[model samples]
Each structure stands twice: as structure tokens, then as C-alpha cells.
Target: MQVIPLKYGTIFKRAFGQPDVFCQFTKDILGIEINIDKVHTEYEYPEPIGFVRSKYDLFAEDTEKRIIVEIQQVKEDDFFDRFLYYHLISMVEQVGGYQAYGFDRTVYTIVVLTSTPRDGSINFSCAVSDMNPIDEYGRTFVVYPHRLVFLCPRQVNDKTPPLVKKWLNFIEDSLDGEMDEVDYPDTFWKKIMAAIQKQTINPALLSEIKDDAAWEEAKIRFVAEGVEKGLGKGREEGRAMLLKQQRETVLQAREMGLDEMAIAKLTGLTAQELKKITK
Candidate 1:
């Protein structure tokens, strides 16, 4: 479509994880009046592999608490690993210079994730939510009084919940050069279009971007030369060497009474090919 979401958040994070994207969200998205007193990226806590060290997409400070925004594309089962790490990082402010090593400070972690669960089928494939949250003031809610929420696709409709309504639309759908009618702020829309235009409007960037999109498209082309190259590269010599090795393995497996499906899975050879070998 016309515009893509301002992701490359990972890319942007790589460039400016300390203060740019991290601070933008708190000030812009949350409409919070907080001055960024300090900011750090790749925060490390001296401990083991899973201990207080994490490279955040963006991490920063405000007047009251530390705001950590993690930009992720794919969702994994152990996603809470992100929250757990951020929880640890929040301890940094209180334990200034490691003196107060175990003090509890507030942290706001918002994970921007992939598409949402459509039709409210409870798609928790890549999400962890408090099966319950306390209403702060009807405008805000917190899960376990620590984290906020994950923004995904299905949360973008006119009637969807407010937390992700802006974010979901920015990523899934494109803007029609008209931002007023939409839900997200105009400045946020500008950031979105800036990301998309970087990948589309320029001649060279367009070639690269469209090539990325087109490569995913499947098309068939018959070519004798490709087949010839496949066959002619050490044709008989390599073939004899590997064929014997492969055939011997297949034969041994067959002798063990394994079925055709099992042999196919092991060798990546077609059932028909395995049958020919056996015969």
C-alpha cells in the first residue's frame, strides 16, 4: 500500500536506542509531561546469561519512572523473557551505581508485536496479558501493576480497544494521504509515512523495496541451462560417489523395515525415488 509502519524500529534502535524512539513514545504516545533526565542502551547488570543484562529496542528515563519499549516482529513462546528483563532494568534507577542493588522502582514496558487476534478468538500465540488488570482511572490499566500491553493487528478497528488502536493501524493498513480521519496523531502518521517513503518513493529505494516484495512472489521459469549446470557439474564423478553412499544408507534403513515415509523424511528423497532404490 501507500505507507508502512515506522518499524525498522530495530534498525532505528540500532542507530539511536538510547533516547530517540524510546523517548518519542512516552512523550508523544502517552502524552506524558516528563523530561528525559537520562538514557542508556544495552544496559548490563553484572550477572549470568539470563540476569540483569538486556539490549532494548529503546530505553530511557522520565520524571517519575523508566520507560522501556521493545520493538519486536515475531512472537515466541517464552516472550515474557522480555518483561522479566525490563523488570530487572527498572531496578537500575533505585540501585544507582549498584549501591542500592535491590530496590524496586516502577517500569512501563510496552511490547509492540505482530498482528492481533481477529474476531476476539483469544489469540495469545505471541502475547501474555493479565487475565486481569486494575482500572487506573478508566483511561489506563496495568497488568499486575507493572506492564501495560502488547499492540497487535486486530486491535486497529474503529471499535477495538484504545491501547493499540493507533499502533495496529499504522502497521497493518496504509494511509490514503489523509490522516485526519484516522485515529493516530498526525505527527505519528508523519513518522509512518517517512518510514514507508524511505523504502518506496526514491528510485533506488523503490527498486530495492519492490524487489523485496516481488521475490516473495512465486513464479516458474523453465530453463535447460540451469538443468545442464546441475547435471554437468562433476556429473558422473560426484554422482557415483554420493549415489552409492546414499543408496547404501537407504538400503540399510529399508532392511530395518522402516516405511517409505520414514525413509523419505530421513533422506529428503521422494517416495518414488526410494522405491526405485529398493527395487
Candidate 2:
């Protein structure tokens, strides 16, 4: 049986939007236990306090922490910077008065990337940003509790923790429409699997999936035609034209949220070549 992938924003929000599921996910991924009163999806602050307003995919709060979870399907050039801004916003919003210099709640920003990340150092399924103050002798002090965590399901390996790996594997399998409850024996996974079953998805969500598929197909055809046209030119001119086309396609695909591996296959470009083009 086919299951709707949680990588999609709509499906992701629907599945993890539940308070219990969100809490379980947080505990599994970050090793933090939070009893959130509610899970807010596509959450926006009531008033714009900064020069630019930020909308979060998932936002929740307990007494001592503010949680921001963002699901990113596309690999953008400024992916890191964008999330950093969101993380800061969550922290800054706590400022109420001039005398209140201390933040009451610690902010935790967790980013889940469905596609391969642009940073090569993030070669694992999960990683956390280090904000501890370190001395010359390597002694560290935890003055700051705010944290940033990144989860890349596409990068799972045997080294990955079993609890985290199961969730990452579930995400990978869902993308291929092959999610199985047997593989995810946890009760939490059972609930998530039932939540995103293809047959149970609403009509509107199914329509969105159909539209997205059509758009992806169109992008592939566009790349193919560009390659064909470039090959019809003079030998030397054709090579240059083809290179230009591939670069343009790479940029377009990145903006459309297409993963790097798929873009390389479609453009007939190697990983090194794609990196150069993107750079």
C-alpha cells in the first residue's frame, strides 16, 4: 500500500502537528522532553517585530523552552542563513522591557531537510550546533542553552542512533511510497503511519500532490529540450551551449526544491561539476 510522504509541508504539518507526536519526535531527535500545550504549524507572530517577518513550519512552547521546527524540502544557497534568522527571531521575541536583559525561555531550532544538504560536513542523519563557551585548554562551559539541530534523512548511516535512524528511514521510505508499519514497531510510528496513509488523505492534499508531480515532470522535460537544442549547434558552440544550459537547469532545480542527485542525473553533470555550477 502507498503512503503519502511526510516530506511534503502539508503532510508533515498534519502528521506532526499533534502535541503528543511532536513531543515524541523532539525527545527522539534532541533528547529533550517537552510537554507542549499545543503544536502550531505555519505559525506566525501576531505582530511583525522585526524588519522581516518569519513564519515557522512548527512552533511550540513549554514553560522553559520555545521550539521551532522547520521542514525544508529544497536545498537553497542561503539555507543556513535563513534558518539562523528564524532562530534569532524566536529568541529575540522574548524581549519585553529594557530592564529585562535575560531570556525566560531557551530557544531550540530544529531543521529537517528532506533533500541532501549543501554542507558536506553534515554527512550524518543528525547533528547539533555547538554554542558552548570553550577555554584554551578545551574546557567548555554551558552558558547558553539555546540550540540548533539539523536532521537530514537522506544522509542516514549505520553510525546513526537507532531511534533517530528509524525515523529517518521511515521518511526515506515514504518518499518512494513504500512506508511499512512493521519496520516502525514503535507506537508513535504506528500513529504517524496511520495519519499519512494515502487512502485516508483528504482530496485537497491529493490534488496538491498531483499538481506537484506535474510541475516536476514539466521541469524534467524543460531540461531535456534545452539539452537537445544545445546539441544541434556547431561542435564547439554546442559544448559551450550545453554547459550553459546545464548550469541554468541546476539553478532552476535548486530553486524548485529538487535534490542535487536528481538534478545531476537529469543534467548529465557530475557532482563536482554541479557544485562548481552552483558555486
The C-alpha RMSD of each candidate to the native structure, in angstroms, is 11.1, 14.1
Q: What are the per-model numbers of colliding residue pairs? A: 1, 0
Candidate 1 stretches greater than 4 Å from native: 1-8, 11-24, 27-31, 37-52, 96-105, 115-145, 157-159, 174-188, 199-279
Residue pairs with backbone atoms closer than 3 Å in model 2 (clashes): none
lDDT of 2 by residue, 1-279 (tens): 578776777788888888998898888887889987899988998878589989999999999988888988653568788988898888788886898678799999999988874557557788888578999999989888899988889999988899888778877888887665777788878888888899998898889877766775676589678878777756778778887888888999989999989998888888999998767
Q: Candidate 2, after superposition: displacement of residue 206 in Å?
A: 2.3
Angstrom error of the Cα, residue 245, model 1: value is 34
**What C-alpha lDDT values do all the predictions have?**
0.54, 0.83
Residues forming the 10-long window of minimal summed lDDT in candidate 2:
115-124
